[model samples]
Target: MSFRSILHDMKEELGSISRKGFDVKLGHGFRSKSQRVVQDNFVVIDAFKQSCWANMPPELLRDVLMRIETSESTWPPRRNVVACAGVCRSWRETTKEIVKTPELSGKLTFPISVKQPGSRDTLIQCYIKRHRGSQTYYLFLGLSSASYDDGKFLLAAKKCRRPTCTDYIISMNPEYVSKGSSAYIGKLRSNFLGTKFTIYDTQPSNAGAKMTRSRSTRLVGSKQIAPRAPAGNYHVAHIAYELNVLGSRGPRKMQCVMDTIPASAIEPGGLAPTQTEFVNNNVDSFPSISFFRSKSIRVDNCQSEAIPIRKEGMLCLRNKAPRWHEQLQCWCLNFNGRVTVASVKNFQLVASREDGSEHESVILQFGKVGKDVFTMDYQYPISAFQAFAICLSSFDTKIACE
Candidate 1:
């Protein structure tokens, strides 16, 4: 039937159903039919019955009632929300779908749990039942510092600004029973340190974990490369190419190598030209790759893979190697570090000829180089380069003076 016709039929049915006989007394105390209005036992229930006997289908009527229950209202109408649910079996079925089988309160929202003799995880189960189809959701947590005044400002200006998720502070449990490649299987405690409150996933988790949208997904920059994979032979070989010092001296530039080393710059370890040979074999005045032994190759700072090479080579002393001045926010990449008797490339420490042909790149050690006396390359296939670079067994930090 047409919707108008259907609505007309429903409206008629709703009008026909008389709640006049349902004594105003029936809604409250179990008063006899003749009970007076003086007692707290009556409902001018025509309004309630009107709500219950909605001319439309029970499903549609229920949906209407649900919207009303959640929308803005002055006097709490849970009673109204509940009263319509009890009119008849059909009505009961619809309302039962909404009213708390067991009501919920205090720091929680959703389907309620009623107490009974049976054991039930009503609170949790009700939530699970609602979202069982969609199994996973992420949570991001951030701890920040802000003054009380900021909190007031935040409450008012939240619509205009965004929260910064730069740093996080949390106390870690001293002990944990881990699961298969995860900690989710174990219990965790969050009696974390003192901090400020701001907008984020501020939802509290009694179970020690809260999930919310604002505190989830972290943003990353495109220039940010992934962490180092397990140190391998390929990386060792890559560094070997970086250490190859054969930059063209005569200003004839080299070409781009793409992701790999340039074909002309691909001399392997133990195959570099020594200083004497480079000076004698001065075919085109290319800087010697095997010219100097590495006095030291170290990985410093938290980058873990920041290879710094303190070796013997022609440094670009005249024009200072470009450097990044943090305070100035200026980048002088090539003119800051050890000299490149060569040119520079995009995101690289390249030593190239005048035509910008790449010759050599700076390479530092791979694995952990500790403070004490441990070798440069221990855990992988990088022994050859170490031997090739070490001219003197030890530099002058110890017994023999330089």
Candidate 2:
């Protein structure tokens, strides 16, 4: 059946379900006011449980959802897949299972996909727009030139400057960009000289992830009405720029230690931790993923402290050394024309072998397309969060590295 027909059928079923009569007064014998309210909630829940959509067979539902997912591959149509997930809990679980991780499909179907890694075979092209006046940066999922028209919003970060270091508060919510916001996911912090940087995720990156001493309760709303999981900054990666002793002419050398990912992940049949769900305690409140098209503003200011880096058998990445162009008299690496201008921020990252050799295939590349605009393309074994944090490190002014 066509997508329009499927949508019409779904709407009709939902409308009929909503119109089903339920006698709320049947629970009038409760002793206390709160007890009566709870009983009423149960009744409503029971009514929803009896809905035809909720009672559909798991196998049939899975097949139908899979068909919808396969047919609608791109946006306005892709929204149908998301709509299917929002039908009910059973449908949501089935849809989630059908949708592949971005590491394999290169599609951002859900919000959690941002936390997951990119595709292994193809580079997911994205771009970042920097608002200098506000010190906030927005990350989008496509290479649209006209204000994110052909693009989808992915993540946003607000730069907070301090005396000793800098912190970029990353959040899925574009409107409220802060550590306290429910959308807050991770952050990128720099050291005093801007040479050393740390990437932190609110949720654990791996199964054996250790808890840091800086854990805090995630506030729900502006009034802090409800509390959820502890939104702590778990160390995920570390980035450091080598000081340029020759000075003024050499390219910036950088290295990244992926604490959560092992060096073996780049090998065949290797695995890395993938986050299937979000950090929120209740999944019901986050049933569907929605994209916002507005600019984000800073909501809170939080201080940063030194967190010791602990690395053992972890994956290491370094800049793919650029060749000296005798004709242009400048360093150059092929960005596949994704990059237009030559800037010191332009660099490609590749995994370092155990024997100290770098891989030929570029895993991530960030380069300038225009003033305050840069293209960020990343592939598997590293998430958009990690890649964006690593790119943010390049924005820090490294006087010593220069």
Candidate 3:
């Protein structure tokens, strides 16, 4: 019999039973066997009724599903597209086509947790893409869960207008700004045509709302290179962080080597030039000297008296040498701190050693704690602000963004 005939017969049987008043009740208000059988038949008929949509034309069905997916107004739409794909074979194929379009997939989402105004100890994830035609790069920084698009926007950075400009204005997402506050965080300024740059914290002070260069941390090549040379001409052999200080003679330098050379830039049958070459060429440059405050006091008579003092410890950024990962197919940076290897995504920071062995202890850890939030842990000597800045830097294209 036709589907319509079966459906009609089932409806007629249900109506006839209702009109007959054949309400047979079992013990404790349970339905009688006859009622149960009728209910089961209804369920079977309903299942067939639901299957009618399965015969819909592929194009029409896909259009309906696409509407449902796009109707979600939030970043990382709440309706799980991947889950929808699992419903049937046709849906899976259609989902693949829908997601491949750049309009749907190019953007990323991250959940953000902002504890207070100007808080730096927050976890952020950055997505970076380089546009070769424009010779520029774009960064989408956010907090997200499961690497899905349900990300909350935090900050964004783009190259300045000038073609030779290496400066990028790192701005706060307007949606995150309060009524009276400005959306400016700071600027990433490069010195030698992307060879070196400083992260200038331009956050306004709470009391005066004045824009001050609160803290400046520098990232530079380990060996000095001429300012005029194209940055890509030489691999980013070594990258260092120059810690910001207060009333100090100069910033302290902590350096690490990086295999930042792209495979395309590698010369055939030869390694990149050694650091020794740059050292030899710049020997005439004068190095700044630092002066330490005297801790000892001079006695009234003439003798010098030594004072009992607590030892001051230095804070450093320590990590193991970044290694290439076959699965990730990108270099991995593992730190010797609270962060576990699993929490790290995209890349990490590993400590370099003189003896050429990896360091097992981590000095700082920036790990995800929630869908839109991350935690920062660091030992003394590294302020929360400095650690936060370092984490933010991770979201940019290390070589090009500099």
Candidate 4:
């Protein structure tokens, strides 16, 4: 039998037992109050533990789940694995151990994977759709090339502008993008000039991480309603756009300082941090353990003090210089045909060494694929949250850079 069919049958069997096995009515009219209470409690507890699927042999359960995990390798069909996880606690734990992180499997199976590092060599292809009316952006994992095809949703962000700065509030939920919403994960905020930006994570990026004192709470309205959980904004990366002094319009130049990643991570025998699970957003709970968490750096001074181009041992990325196209009369960087119709926002990023040389492999690239639509592909040393925030910066109006 197919794996899904097997699982469905087991669920039906469990449902049947739950409906019939717990039909014993509460107290008998003849029984004393104390005796009835104890008997009723026992019946409730017993029924809770005896939902039919609990009786399945461990060996059989593992074998069935193993088959399901091995069969579905990509999304849509791959959602079967996710379905298995929700079956019960036993199924959820089993699936957790079976599914690998995006760094190893290159598959984003869980919501947490969006916060973890991607595979070193393979690009996780995704696209963004912009809604001008609502000032929101939706990120989706491209399942097919057809623009009309509904892709798997990944993340969403709503642009909020202020007199001094602009904020791109990002969330996992398409319906809610406010800081008070549990779905709020992270955001990108820019300075008055829109030349410098900071990326903030709702949870600590690593153990012993600290939040900036200035922006520890929700940022809008005269009075703030604290989140239902203990969510802190941790500064993970800083982005800066170089100003054009010649007074000529050209492709935007930018650099990103990845504070959490060490420069050595790009060299041989080096490693980058990779998160394995999502943190609990409940106020009563604490962050979950995954890999070693990186120390959080205070970014309160970033706006007042100038950030250096290259840090001592931190990873830095710069825009890949595009070659002048003689025929088209426009500068271009090859996006492997993923990008078309060039605009000033079109750019690819590569890790740069202290010597000012750039790694040939593009770590992240964003470009227009259609009107109100863009393609964002990234891999290695960065999570989808970081990448999406960086792309959002490209959408900002940079009067200085242009």
lDDT of 4 by residue, 1-402 (tens): 777787688667556644664432222111111111225546534442455555567788788888898899877888788876765567667788888888888888888888988877788888999999999999998787654457888999999986667889899889988776767888888987889898888777678565753343532333333644234567778899999878774688899998788888878767877766656644333332233223343333224235567778889999999888899888988998888877888889999999988898899999998889999999988889899999999999987777
lDDT of each: 0.23, 0.77, 0.34, 0.77
Q: Which ten residues in a row have the lowest lDDT in candidate 4?
A: 28-37
After aligning candidate 2 to the native by TM-score, how far in Å is the CA of 226 from where it should be? 9.8
Residue pairs in clash, model 2: none
User: CA shift at 217, candidate 2, in angstroms?
Assistant: 7.2
Model 4 accuracy (lDDT, Cα): 0.77
Q: Which stretches of candidate 3 lie over 4 Å from their true place?
A: 1-145, 161-165, 174-181, 204-314, 323-347, 350-402
lDDT of 1 at 220: 30
User: Over the stretch 1-402, how does candidate 1's per-residue lDDT look in tens digits?
Assistant: 443353355445544543333333233211113222332575434333354353458667777656645541212324444444444445545655653322121101111111110111211110000012222111111011211111100000001111221111111111221111111111111111101111111112122323221111111331111111111011111111122235432211111111112223223331211111001111122222232234332111101122223112211101113455679655444322222222222122233343434434432111111221111111011111121111011110111111
Where does candidate 2 have its weakest 10-residue lDDT segment? 26-35
Give the better candidate number (1 or 2) by TM-score: 2
Off by over 4 Å in 4: 17-48, 214-224, 281-306
Model 3 lDDT tens row, 168-238: 54444433321112343444444332333344433221222222111121114332232321111111122
